[model samples]
Target: MPTAVQALCANFPDLTPPATLALRLEALMPSRRLPAGRVLFAQGQSPSAFYLVEDGEIEARFAALDGRMSVLEHVRAPRLFGLAAFISGKPSRYEAAAVSDSRVRVIGAPAYRVLMDDWPGFARALMREFAERFEGNLRLLEAARHLSAAERFGVALRQLADERAGPSDAEGWQALRATQAELAQLAHLSRQTVNQLLRAAQAEGRLRLRYGGLDIRR
Candidate 1:
């Protein structure tokens, strides 16, 4: 293994003494970046790789027959996306897009299976990531089921707040890159409804938008 690859894999229990991180990565995964609003992959496309976010955000979205995209999941920094169809041998059921300029790790199927064969814990870790994403999606779905549009928006903020510890006093720079229209889809409401909710939240000091990004305060 190259020195850097060894260093990178030192903390990873599944890592092998491969040629290099870059070489093993060619087998394991490669990094990817996509522009804002561009689809990384579409529903029913070949599932080639599993993705883990290194930076920025990705929304796992689906477009209706009416041509509107609904967000099923929001993947933030240091999280994973693009694993569903990758593991299941199905075409992607949704589209993934950068909510902003983003970076992600793309693990090819061949290399991933190799890792799975050698590292039980690594395999379990991937499965665990999928479970977490699934449950998080369910929580949003449930919130939309019971909450009013405005309240659903509140719920989204609360969820994000919980993720970033908005309820705690650990405030810092954060970005909610979702546009109101996008938030509408996630909240299962109209853009106007989302705007109204956002306005309300802003008035109450729970959210504040800077020039390019929105910040949520608990």
Candidate 2:
């Protein structure tokens, strides 16, 4: 079996750490398998461990009134989660859960700091990833401020379709495997508005509302 460092290196080939940092990571990181829908951490929880997704998807979300959820991010393999709290020395900003059965490497804050100190590449990679997330959040904030609900829904569907499309399926119809409520939360809209938007799109042949999700077509 691969050591923790080796597994991390394999997952993130471009962000290879030096020998000393690798040793430290191996000592500090432990792998865990999470079943689908497992809650990794919750909002307001004290920060202890950050995670690297070895396989599958993790969702970071905020719980709202009436039990609704607003998605913060969807993290895939080779990506890190819970870093915002780790860096800020605050409680977790959002709850994290396994979106599918997933393997994750749990790294404590101390080890993460060591890696950041000793591995320039690793630090750079983390910075880049976090920066992208920040930019995405900023865009979402801007969209919520200025865009109509319909426009936000359209943008959300197009983006989700692109992310799910395979190379062969590119330029063809695409499916979004999220419920209407989930899509509404992600797009910062209400379910009623989401339904209206979907109905309009379906009428125009731009998309079809399915039992669980949406099928978007060009």
Candidate 3:
């Protein structure tokens, strides 16, 4: 198998950086292996480095005063996270933790700046990532403003399914590996509401709940 950095670099096939730059980055940056449920960074902490998820999944989450945790984003492999704090020179607004066994490449601010200054491909890739995230956030805001709770739940489920769908069966059903609580957090709904919505969907033959996840019909 390719190394984590090699896999990450492969993601930007159209915006390939120079081999020298890629090698330099690989040499300079450090990789961290996080076990499932390990906290990579905590909310309110200073950003020492931004991360690129090279393997597995990392969840960005917010903790309320009452100890309720809401997931803001589920970042999968070959994606970047923690950039806003790194760029703005501010503390992180939310925590990031490994949702599964994961490996992440840590890029310090100095190295990031150097790459941005020297590598046009790297700079363009970052800009593209930022633009896509900004557009997605805008869509989410619009959904929250206009959609009902059930509608929002459907939207969230579809999004998660798109992101992490397993192999489809002969009947065109795809499995999503997520819990009701995680879905609740993602949809910004209560667990009870999620359960009700899930039951309704199942009753309608839209999905089937399994031991650890759900299978949704296409």
Candidate 4:
């Protein structure tokens, strides 16, 4: 448990100093791994652990009524996830799957509870993580709710713009790993509609679909 802190100090972007960071991290987290396409957790599954990405990437995918996979978001190394269910004692809202080979820290409910009581700094970190997830989830819901298809398409571009503009020094843009079909499900439209929208955006210089993924200039 104690050594866990050192790993966090090295792994986390927001890590503080060594000893204190180590003390803050140790015992509060547990590490695990999953292969590509492996399900780390599933929607409607009971929450037993919260996850923090240490390496590799994960996709937060929601299953549609028609049994389609809609990727809500991608979580990369150093990002945090799975905590929302832990905190709420509810089933997962999305199925978390490894996008590639991955490693993560699982903060069990008991350990998280203990740390929140005994370690102020670690508690703050945990709370901050939870807050981030809450806000992001809220934003996603709000954008999707009460919107027509065209409005949803507009929201998607705005989201792409925001994601692509994030700190290059922090990490390169979030991988545009989403397929056109996934975008269609997310936007509640057909794949052909998504392609048309993408082309329109591209022609307007709002975005460019590169080999790896789509690029948003704005």
**TM-score against truth, every candidate:** 0.72, 0.75, 0.83, 0.73
Q: Which residue pairs in model 2 clash with each other?
A: none
Poorly placed runs, candidate 2 (over 4 Å) = 1-13, 19-23, 65-67, 158-165, 168-181, 190-218
lDDT of 2 by residue, 40-138 (tens): 988889768888888888988988778777887677766677887877788886899998999888889778778778777777777786787677776
> Which number leads on lDDT?
3
Of the candidates numbered 1 and 3, which has the greater TM-score value? 3
Better of 1 and 2 by TM-score: 2
Model 2 residue 143 CA deviation in Å: 2.3
C-alpha lDDT of all candidate models, in order = 0.67, 0.76, 0.81, 0.67
Per-residue lDDT value at 89 in model 4: 88
- Which lDDT tens digits does candidate 1 get at residues 1-218? 12323322432436454333346555466667787887888888967887666667888888789987777867775566777687778898898888889877676766676567754466666676577657867778898788777678766665555444323335654555556665677678888878777788789877787664478643
Q: Compose the digit string of candidate 3's lDDT tens values, residues 135-171.
A: 7656555666789999888878876786678999899
Q: Indicate whether candidate 2 or candidate 4 has the larger lDDT.
A: 2
Scored by TM-score, the top model is 3
lDDT string, candidate 4, 66-154, tens digits: 99777677677556677777778888878999989998888786666655665446667767766765675566566678777667776
Higher-TM-score candidate of 2 and 3 = 3
Query: How high is the lDDT of residue 50 in model 2?
Result: 84
2 against 3, candidate with superior lDDT: 3
